[model samples]
Target: MEIQNKSAGRLIKLIISGFCIGLIATIGACKKDNIKKEYPQGSNEQINTWILDSLSRYYYWAAELPKKPGLGQSPVAFFSSVKNASDRFSQLYLPNQAGVSSSRSLYGFDYAVIQEPLSLEVLGLVKCVLKGSPAERYGLKRGSYIRKINGKIFSSSNVVALDQELLTGRTIKLTLTELKDGGYIDQPELNMIAGLTFEQPVLHQVIERGGLKIGYVYIDGFSAGMASTLVSVFSGFKSAGVSELVIDLRYNSGGEVSEAAGLCAMVAPGLTYNTDFIIYKGNKNGGQRKESIGEAATFDKRLDFNALLQNNLSLSRVFILATGATASAAEVVINNLKPFMKVTVIGEKTVGKDEASFLISDQRIPKQVDWEMYPIIYKLFNAQGQGGYAGGISPDLELSEFTLLPLVPFGNANDALLSKALDQISAQKVNAGLRSSINEARSVSQIGRILSDSHLAKATQSIVLTHR
Candidate 1:
């Protein structure tokens, strides 16, 4: 992650669009005196008005908003009331205590606090850990349980506070645990702090089944630096002569559109300097932008046509493991590849985030004010002019990881999702009983955190403003 000391105008111009979900100005710095005298300092209505003004201008569904939301309501509540009833991705975040720029940092680990099947108490389950992160250094691997945070039990109500604490505080204490013999066993306590960590976008391992080499890659999320990491991963896969690929995007919330294009260029039919990838279309208020899977996709490491071909798997079909967490830039991969190859999506349906968002802040306001808005600004489509996955793209093979208790490691053959993908490749008979079990569990159980907390887990505070 690059630490950019950005001016308000320059920050607005560098908008990057992705899954987790930004303005321009050269204006005089806004002093406190610039605000109206009639409104008392820090009044809820005044803050709410600022949010409403920005939403009315840039929100994708601005026309649908209520004319005058309740003035007395809390600023956060008022902001919610004005939002389009259907748009779940648009969000508001209070800036870090230091200032707005620190909002771009992540918690290092994406965990889910779920209901313990036996006790029915909320328990945190690790989803994905960034490589070399404090969480990883503290030995927080996927499937490990979190019993407490700062010695306080985490329930649905206080989870948001936990998130805020992790994001803003200098240090945090985590009581890690695990499920053993139908009971929670305490592990070592960890005192950790947030730090800038560069995540390895691609995690890969090859498996040999029936004389075919299957390459498995787990993409945590797509950020600016992932294109080169992907190239290296695919290059290794090519050298090893893998015949099939399984991409695990169950936790990918989305990032940089360019990086999405780069990954698609590698797997899609055309690997060249200028291959059309996807179309960016917005509402009546905004114009459209066309982007290609070309040189623009990979910033630092631009491979020539032949070098791209050498790294290509050349397979007609691939398997993707997705959940509601698979969204935005991740969905771009699924949607863009459909036209050229066979994309078999396994696991649950994705987060229907066909629309992209922008990070918009009132340039007139100074950084001391902690409010920022991310509103849906455009809809995405493949080259074929096909999109409208607002409800999310369904999987071809419907299975959920919730069916497997004590969630198995990434490449485990018995893991329901991966096993099904491998079964398809090996031509083995589908396990009807396992499929039925997963289907049954779908109605009653869930893999990760409570439904209320899922949205918070997916909201990336980084601004991806595409235009001024």
Candidate 2:
């Protein structure tokens, strides 16, 4: 996952506070065909009026909205005033703020903070580095450990204070280290500044082990028009005779529903244009809407349905690698496919966000409003009518990457989650580490607590809709 910054405000705040695993909320992001080109300069009074009106019409919990929130309040605060207590992902962004935390602040790397059990020293484990980002330019990578930022070393004591400086600091200097054979060796310092950078969301690899060719796909996020990219990638996997599939959504940020539908179309077999994909049960004004697999896959004829059918893996089962960071769109695939095939999820449970939202900029052309509101719009459901996963989707096999320590990059057989999935596929007996429910209860169970914390872990997912 790239160092993308989501307007997922609270997740980062709490993660930075405790060195706990964090999740971010985001959406497919809505865009109007023509709105006011200029930013709005409306008074708080006018903004609050618009906010209340919009929420009433489209908010999933419109019935729960407060009847009277003083219009004098700031828009951000005002929006929060009416937001349902149950709503976690509904957010209001000031001008240039994240509708989905736009790419303006991305640094092209992602990290997980850990407090090593033995030394009690905190460490930043580089989980991923996007190609061409400053982090990659400085040789940062997965499994690399950050011992110091600027000149301050990490300790169990100082983690809370060091949080924002790492992400929002003007310039960051990192002291890198390698964990080798029970000790750490200091490496050359890496210096860089966070800059605007982006990458193709999908990363794929073909692994051949014991005469079984497995396709490993780590999807960072689902973006609009990703179906073609998925088609091309899966076509390659098909050509190479890849038989099994492992989809790594451990770091997946939230993304678009249609794009998710497209990905599902290519992976799950025996689905036609009318096959059910997602059901949007909206507020009274917005009503329940069902989206078909083909409608989302084709995206107005931008993609060929036959092309998706051609690239379909048609496997009996799929292994989904997930964590608390796996967003709603990814979870949609996991839940919706259950009726059709077996979905074996590895690693920790999911972030448990099932609702969908869209960007609500001023609807008018040459709009009067300067604000963007991402309101909770619908309760999501699948074909079998499974919904209400607000507690998060539990993993079939409970696993944690942090348990083994010194996180390995994706696709490495030594990687904890990948190794577990492979073991299941090959019918290998669970290793001592895996077999002992006692051990899983010890480390992984603890991670489950941290990942499900009300503050640290949030269901920060929303699907962008082109229409109401």
RMSD of each: 15.7, 18.3
Encode model 2's per-residue lDDT on 1-468: one tens digit a residue: 233455456667876866533222112122342342332458787888888888888889988888667888888888877788888788787776543321123566666567665445567767778777777777887767788877788765665555456655546888987755556778888777777676555778998766799999888777777777888899999999988899988877557777777788878878888988777798888898887888766766778888988899888899999887786787887887786778999988888778888788897887888888778798888877788887888999998776654466677776779888888887774455533322112243333212111112323534434333
The lDDT of each candidate is: 0.70, 0.73
lDDT tens digits, residue span 194-277, model 1: 777675646688988888999998887778767667887899888899989999888777877777776777776655666666
- Model 2 residue pairs with clashes: 3-109, 25-460, 36-366, 36-367
The segments of candidate 1 whose C-alpha lies over 4 angstroms from its true place after superposition are 1-86, 91-107, 118-122, 150-173, 178-184, 188-196, 270-274, 295-307, 358-374, 429-456, 459-468
RMSD of 1: 15.7
Q: How high a TM-score does candidate 1 get?
A: 0.71
After the best TM-score superposition of candidate 1, give how far the Cα of residue 414 lies from its true spot, in angstroms: 3.9
On a 0 to 100 scale, what is the lDDT of residue 3 in model 2? 36
